[model samples]
Target: MINAKNLTKRFGKVDALKGLNLHVKKGSIQGLIGPNGAGKSTTIKILSTLVIANSGDVTINDIPLKRGVSVRSMIGVVPETPRLHENKSARSELRFHAKLYGMSQKEAKSRISDLLYAVQLEDAADRPIRGYSTGMKKRVALALALLHEPEILLLDEPMSGLDPVIRKQFKEIILDLKEMGKTILVSDHDLYTVEELCDSVTIIQDGKTVVEDTIESLRHETGSIAIELRVSDDSTMDGLESKLTSLDCVTDVSQKRGWVIVKVRDSKTDIPVVIHTASNHTDILEAKQTKITLEDIFLKFAGGHHG
Candidate 1:
């Protein structure tokens, strides 16, 4: 439902985005992730029509984004740090946005009540936003964004700086939105959250698109699997690394905290062989495939830059 091609943006001499292309299917949550200055926010700004790109073509639901072409009505944007009127109550804030969208008094009130309940801010809806916690503020921003019920949602670092409990709540809200068939493009620094929430991820680095695919597909395409084996004792790990390394499918092996980690060519066949080899030397405490995490994939693409 969202498409951008050859998007480029610059500030003075620094290029924020360079020929970045992105696509999000309808009813799917797509993640845009990168280190600092990788242009994730810039991409979202362009998509939200908050900032015009230096060069590119963009469309939401086939309606082109150009001068005088109104795409804002079709998009809901919740910035990384949403700027809400601190003194205004959550209900009032949403009401203002609803009126801005030209909703009638009755319709706006009904929608505002539903959104407050949806964000779980019903009791505190009458309280001024300045007294709310960071997570609560995010919920208010989200409710404001959905006031008009836009078809597309752009959330930039919506879960950043949130505690585990609040982050979980926020994730559930996003999932609920997805269930309602909203096309979502979320930019986040948290790889774990992105992996859990997004259907597909687009990794950009140095102002360029590095990779875009489902997490499982990226792991498969990377073709590196780690098999972790815990021996009963450290002495049992001795010579085990060499033995595993000698195998045809084993690429590399290392010991950590009394556990032998073997990088293999194939997990399905190599793991069984690794287990059999270790069984000859030591009693196995634990043997399992070490699943590759999103952090591993991000490090590979971003070169360990965690900014």
Candidate 2:
């Protein structure tokens, strides 16, 4: 439902985005992830029409981003740091946003009521936003974003300061939106959350698109698999590492906290060999395969130049 091509943005001499391309399918949640200064926020701002890119083409629902082709009504944005009127109650703030979208008094009130309930802010709807906790404020922001019931949702670090409880709650809300056919593009540093919530992910680094694919596909393409082996004796750890390193499938080996961590080319085919080799060297306390994570992929791409 959203497409951005050849997006390039620059401020002074620093380029924030360099020919970055992102695509989000309808009713799917796409995660945009990168390290600091990797142009994640800049991409969101351009898609939200808050910042005009120096060179790029973006469209929402086949509507090109140009003058007179209104896209704001079709998008809901929840920024990393939401700004709300401190003195205004949650209900009042939502009403204000609804009115800004030209909703009538009756419609605005109905939407405000429903949104407050959806974000679980019904009880505190009348309280001023300044007194709200960080999680509470995030809920208020989410309510405000859905006030217009837009077709597309852009969430930049939506779970930034949320506690575990609220974070789970927020994730449920996103899942519900997806079921309702809302196209969502969410960016966050939490790889686990992204892996859990996103259908596909786009990894960008140094203002460039490094990789974009499903988590499984990315993991397979990267060929990064890990195995954790607990040895009974620390002295035998070096021998175990040496044995595992001799295997052709094994790429690198290291020891941590009395455990030998081995990186392999393919865990499915190489883990058994790793176990057999370790068994001959030391008493195996535990030998388990570790799935490659999104963080591992991010570090592999963003930390260094690797295709």
Candidate 3:
């Protein structure tokens, strides 16, 4: 439903995006994640029509981003920091946007009522936005974004500053939007939320895309299991790493602090051999098995290359 190719943008001498590419399938929630200054916000801004790219091609629902085509009506945007009228109540805010959207009074009222309920701010819909908490303000922003019932949503850090309760509620609302067949592109630093919410992810670095694929495919390609081993003797750690590296099942082995971290392909078969091999070197202090997460994948592909 959304596509961008070879998108590049520059401000003075610094390049915010250098050939960054992204794609989102219809009815799927896609994640855009990277380190700070990796051009995530810049990408979102260009996609939302807030910033024009220096050179690139973009389309929303097959509508090319050109002077004559109208992509704004097809997309809703929830920025990292929502800018709302502090004095206006949520209901009034929605009402104002509804007018800008060209909705009649009856339609605007009904739509505004539904959105207030959807964001769980029905009781406080009439309260001034300035008195609302951060989470409440975000809810208001979300409601405003959905007031037009756009086909796609571009969310830049939607989970930022939200409490656990509000975050959970926000997640549920996003899932509900997916079920309703809305295409979503979320740019967030919260990998856990991305793992839970996204069908696929695009990791970028230094203003370029490093990798883009489904989480399942990334896990399989990057090795899913990690074996963290702490040995009784610090001297034996180096020897253990060498032995684990020679094993066919182990993908990677490295030492950190007093622990030897090993990435393995098959946990069931590899874990035992890994433990047994370490036992031969020295007494085992601790051996724990963990699944490699999105964060691990992020560091593997996008880390150590940042300027």
lDDT of each: 0.87, 0.88, 0.90
**Steric overlap count per candidate:** 0, 0, 0
Residues 194-270, model 2: lDDT tens digits = 99999899999888888888888878765568899998888898888888888898877888888898888866688
lDDT of 3 by residue, 1-307 (tens): 9889999999999999999999999999999999999999899989889889999999888888976666888889998789999999999999989999999999999999988887889999998999999888988988887889998999999888888987998899999999999999998898999999999999999899999999888987888888898888798888888988998888999887888999988878988988888788788988888778999888888878766
TM-score of each: 0.91, 0.92, 0.90
* Pairs with steric clashes in candidate 3: none
Best by lDDT: 3
Stretches of candidate 3 off by over 4 Å are 230-239, 255-259, 282-288
Please identify model 1 stretches exceeding 4 Å from their true place.
235-238, 251-256, 304-307
What lDDT would candidate 2 get against the real structure? 0.88
**Model 1 — which ten-residue stretch has the worst lDDT?**
298-307
Which candidate has the top score in TM-score? Answer: 2
Ranking by TM-score: 2, 1, 3
Candidate 1 Cα deviation (angstroms), residue 162: 2.9
